[model samples]
Target: MSTPLIPLTLLLILTAVLVESQSIIPIRYDGFVYKKRAASTGTVLIEAFYDPVCPDSRDSWAPLKQAVDYYGTNVVSLIVHTFPLPYHDNAFVTSRALHIVNDLNVSATYHLLDAFFKHQEQFYNAQTLGMSREAVLDQVIGFASSTLGNSFKSAIKSGFNDSKTGTKTRVSFKYGCSRGVYGTPFFFVNGFLVPFNDDDTIDYNGWRKLIDPLITKKQHYPSNIF
Candidate 1:
């Protein structure tokens, strides 16, 4: 005997349930835990995939920080993902160093990143400065040590090669690749890729234009704020 067919509405409900389950499921990967500047409830989420050694990434830093400061954590959040491009000889080491710092002190990660960008010329421009890659790496590490302290330096020396660090760095690269990130300083807003112009300048106002409306519409102000 033939079995009775299920109702179409029930099939539709099952399909919807399956789709929702898949959507809510998180993507899990080994290595470094992903970090975010704000809680997931924020209306605006900015995902930045950047390489420390990239000039464009360095240039965008100030404007990005400004946006974070302006919105704070209530309306906006920033998730930083490291994407160390191959040509930047010292990028991987810097990325690894940043990962180590994140483990030790999450707050210091951005400070070290600022240090790297501020002195990119000194370290990344090795050929121009007549310095070797090893020298550049040492300089970067030294900057981290000086800015963060002895423990950071010791961690770098000891844990730079730790499998966990390596795994985190690799996972970052892979995550970027999966997201169609081919270059440094890639930006995504609320899961939508923000189109950047073909120029070195970062348009902070332009970003504000995109972000402000979303905040006005969906973000509820904290009860304490008058």
Candidate 2:
């Protein structure tokens, strides 16, 4: 008697779930800010959706870091959102490792990122072909602990599936998806996605041209010019 109603009810429930998900927003703290700006008024936000094991992301990281370092944290707030690509064998483990680092020791977040970039090849598909996920996770944990410390190692032993760190990692990836990022090394500046084109592949000089004008404009021109 209720078979027809059951199918219609399921459809309505699924639609409501999607609507709720759409209403959710990504918060600023969803990603760990590597270079923090003290104030928001004139700060330029440089956000990266990066896969830790992705080669393109590794290449993009250097110039991005250099640019942010040159600009100083005062002017640029660089936030790295780890968008772990599924095809990468151990990217999720490494991505979760970052959230764990950010959770336990916010200051060592960059150190963990550097460690991952430094040893990226080890976690590649060929290298980790026969390795189980737990083994890869162990390797990641040890690597992170080495970069951070024994104390962090203790905390992170179970942090991957722990509520807070796991949720943070998941949220960062979800936020990247919601922003329409389909690949590693995607970037956003001031909440606007950087369009795909020749200039999208940015170098230090490229970033300077992009950032300098904005800085100068903010300094000289008043906000709300109209």
Candidate 3:
């Protein structure tokens, strides 16, 4: 007898349920949270806090690169600095180099990152990469001048020296501290810090296990950004 009214009531209840779900289900990529670039819509964010002068960090570079390449658009690699040791004098310089390259709005930042790691042994020694202060600046100048230009080279050097004014370095450090990063090679998946030293070795398998799921579940659609 009241079938029409019952249908109407059910429709109203369903609408309310849908509205509540929309409000409660958190959207991940709204904006750049914590100064780290937001992941693309429906994608995962990987915030890596690494030190260029850290031996362990260097060892992780290969696997990290592979993961980034495999994930492609599904992952955003937000690299930050957690420079801990004082003996790694060139660490700050290297960080500034990446920061400057990033400023250029080109992919050269990734290139230099891999290049630096590839040649890490050549620069670093048994006593922390054996890099003298003068040589460190020179290496930066040589790399930037050859690939980018003299202006960029100078900017990199200036950025490294004036830590007081280097916004990028400050931002990186801030991101690290905010995430409770105490050392190099710390990896965060989707804003969550990964547990470390469980197996007494930070190997490629461990990183892949943490990251592969995020990559597989990510979805992408065409964007209007230009």
Candidate 4:
């Protein structure tokens, strides 16, 4: 009798075969999914992939703020993807908490970003070097509860634990990977990542150089959000 053509036969054959190949994957520029700020006009969109706990990001916040003010609504700013590394304890929780604020549509997200910069040490004990995840969540939820209603607390918790969060995290990681980002404070302007260096003393100058030309050319003007 012929051996039965069972599932094992197909499985064995497939296991033996090896697939190897490399393809030129298209690099997804920022414009693929991101949109300009509502008030933006004749202006460029700036996507800043940053981690709240990153010192480099904190240090650059001053200049970033200045730049935003200088350009006003001429430039759209977006903070995407908070990657909390293993070395930085509770960093993930901090990010998760912030995501909660964002999901809740609480303006606190931006305020929290500023707070995180100034009081990161409080949240992250230098000696202990990490805040309790639950504690941080409490702080975020408590602040949001007053205006957003208590539902925000539960929703944040849900979103934080939801599968969508992971998906968004991966998308952010993929975008960063495509842009050759190995660190935080990664900035992208007009669908292209800005090439800059740490302590390059050109943070403001570089931004001005790249954007001024475009603004002058009438590629971008300025507008206000109503």
Quick one: best TM-score, which candidate?
2
The local lDDT score (0 to 100) that residue 35 gets in candidate 3 is 31
Candidate 4, which ten residues in sequence have the lowest lDDT sum?
Answer: 17-26
Ranking of predictions according to TM-score: 2, 1, 4, 3
Lowest summed lDDT window (length 10), candidate 1: 25-34
Tens digits of per-residue lDDT, candidate 2, 1-226, equal 0011235664564455455546666565578777445535568888888889988788778888888889865788788889887678788888988888777778888888987888899989999899888788888888888878887888888787687777677677767666766577888888898765632467888888888998887788777865
Provide the overall lDDT of each model, using Cα atoms, as 2-decimal numbers: 0.71, 0.77, 0.57, 0.55
Which ranking of candidates, highest lDDT first?
2, 1, 3, 4
Cα TM-score per model: 0.76, 0.84, 0.63, 0.63
Better of 2 and 3 by TM-score: 2
Off by over 4 Å in 2: 1-20, 23-28, 196-200, 224-226
Which digits, one per residue and each the tens of the lDDT, describe model 3 over residues 1-226? 0011235664564455455444442222211122333454445666666666666777776776565556545355544453433345666666767766666544566666667776666455453456677776787668766656566766666656665435555455544544555466777666677776622434667667876765555433344533
Q: Candidate 3 versus the native: TM-score?
A: 0.63
Q: After best superposition, candidate 2 residue 218: deviation in angstroms? A: 1.1
lDDT of 4 by residue, 78-162 (tens): 4455655435555666666666566556455666667776766644546333546566666655644544557667776677678
Comparing 1 and 4 on TM-score, the stronger one: 1
**Clash-forming residue pairs, model 4:** 42-220, 42-221
Q: Pick the winner on TM-score between candidates 2 and 4.
A: 2
